[model samples]
Target: MADDFKVTDPRTLRAYAHPLRVRLIGLLRSEGPMTATRAAAALDDNVPNCSFHLRQLAKYGFAERVPGADARERPWRATARTTSWDDDSDDPAMRAATDQLNSVLLGVFTQRAQDYLATRADEPAEWRAAAGFGDMLVHVTAAELRELTEQIEALASRFDDRAADPAARPAGSRPIQLIQLAIPRGPVS
Candidate 1:
């Protein structure tokens, strides 16, 4: 699978902005290939709903059918490990689509955090202690801010291989969601 799926078309971005579609792509990317029925069960969703969404995702090139021994069972796989778009697009449609995608992503991130919090008490002590929920406010120019984000991404990429290959995961390894945001606290000049 490709490492990054860069969306340039607004329609493609909008197509991938749906919550279910986003989650479905994530499932395929992280867990390897599976049929739509299996994906639906994993996501706690129905077959038809997921089947249609999976087709839509395939139409947008976010997913594709994986060849298997059984012709009837067509497994779907994500085209890339991560889906991203250029937030600095000059096109109005691209900007609008990016905004929509970002909004959906923010909702997903919020829900994940809330879900974790709900069962945090039941988690292992080490995991509970390791979970992070902290942010820092720093003063930096736009260039410096960009540099900082790049540095953080580089660090995170060190673990990228583990996601695609479950065998590479060490014992006691569990999925962790790491969200990063660098919003300007004040109005821009």
Candidate 2:
């Protein structure tokens, strides 16, 4: 896994708003280096289409060809451990594009949650025992909300060393997605 985070340009950010591109990036980050043929098989996508999108991803600096693969088979790896963008971009088009990208990401997150819920029963007893779901409605000021999110991020960082080095992970552990959301609803009159 990569240790650095990349900030995207507006055009590149908009390009990532495509659903397949989003899924491909997530797959690369989670599963590591893979050829377009392997990626297409994993996603049930066509190889040529996956290759075209992988090229677009490489063109935008999101992914790159792995070193020392067979001359004919190009294996690609994600360029960054993760990516970030300025969601508060002042430019109208950039802000709109960011909003659209965020919505697509939310859909992906929700779909992952649904998939987990659908198949969790098939998981080992220990994993099923450790899984969870919870929600709360809290009263808080905007500043408090910011502080809350920051604290949560800091806590999550404690377990993130493994992202940069797989050796940092202890034995018997498997990947788990930790989705966080703190949406603010408008005040009712």
Candidate 3:
């Protein structure tokens, strides 16, 4: 198992916050190691462009080339369990980039979910019954919320590692959308 990397530095956060770079990281984090050509195909981006972002991701210490892979056809994977941004002080550029990246990720996943629903609309009743898409509002203490996030992250990590295995998964085991959110109930008192 590889050691987990931390992203506590502001400069590293800024580097990883770029929309495309973040997407690339998320893709690798979720899908495991992949070549630039494959990443480009999955993202609908040019290979060179994706390669550039992958290099930037590598430079930022967010990703690294898998050892023994072809030099010309590099495969990359996320180096850390999490890449986070801390907004202790207002920095307009970093804030804007984070916002934009968040929007891009939401939009892309939303579109993907829509397409999935559309494609499965006419499927068997059992398939339709098994589908789930919903949200909830919850109230919790700050410490409880942190605990919940950590638990969810641990669950995610289990699947993230399993995704790297091609033979261990069933054909019907499609990627499920999991968006874990924790927001304040209202304005801080």
Note each model's CA RMSD in angstroms: 1.3, 2.1, 3.6
Regions of model 2 farther than 4 Å from truth = none
Off by over 4 Å in 3: 1-3, 81-111, 114-127, 151-161, 166-171
Q: Write the per-residue lDDT of candidate 3 for residues 1-189, one digit (tens) a residue.
A: 244565545566667666678678878877788998999998888999999999998898888899998768778888875666554437776666556555666676677678778898687777688876776777777778789889888877776644667677777776666765465778655
Ten-residue region with minimum lDDT total, candidate 1: 65-74
lDDT of 1 at 72: 87
How many angstroms is residue 53 displaced in model 3 relative to the true structure, after the best TM-score fit? 0.5
Please report the TM-score between candidate 3 and the true structure. Answer: 0.72
lDDT tens digits, residue span 1-189, model 2: 456555557788888887788889888998888999999999889999999999999888888999888998889999887888877678988898888889999998888889899998899999998987888888898789889989988988897877657899999888888888888778743
- lDDT, candidate 2, equals 0.85
C-alpha positional error of residue 183 in candidate 2 after TM-score superposition, expressed in Å: 0.4
TM-score of each: 0.95, 0.89, 0.72
lDDT winner among the candidates?
1
Question: What is the C-alpha lDDT profile of model 1 across 24-134, one tens digit per residue?
Answer: 998998788999899999999999999999999999999999865378888999998888788998999999999999999898888879988999999989998999599
Which pairs of residues have clashing backbones in candidate 2? none
CA error at residue 134 for candidate 3, angstroms: 2.0
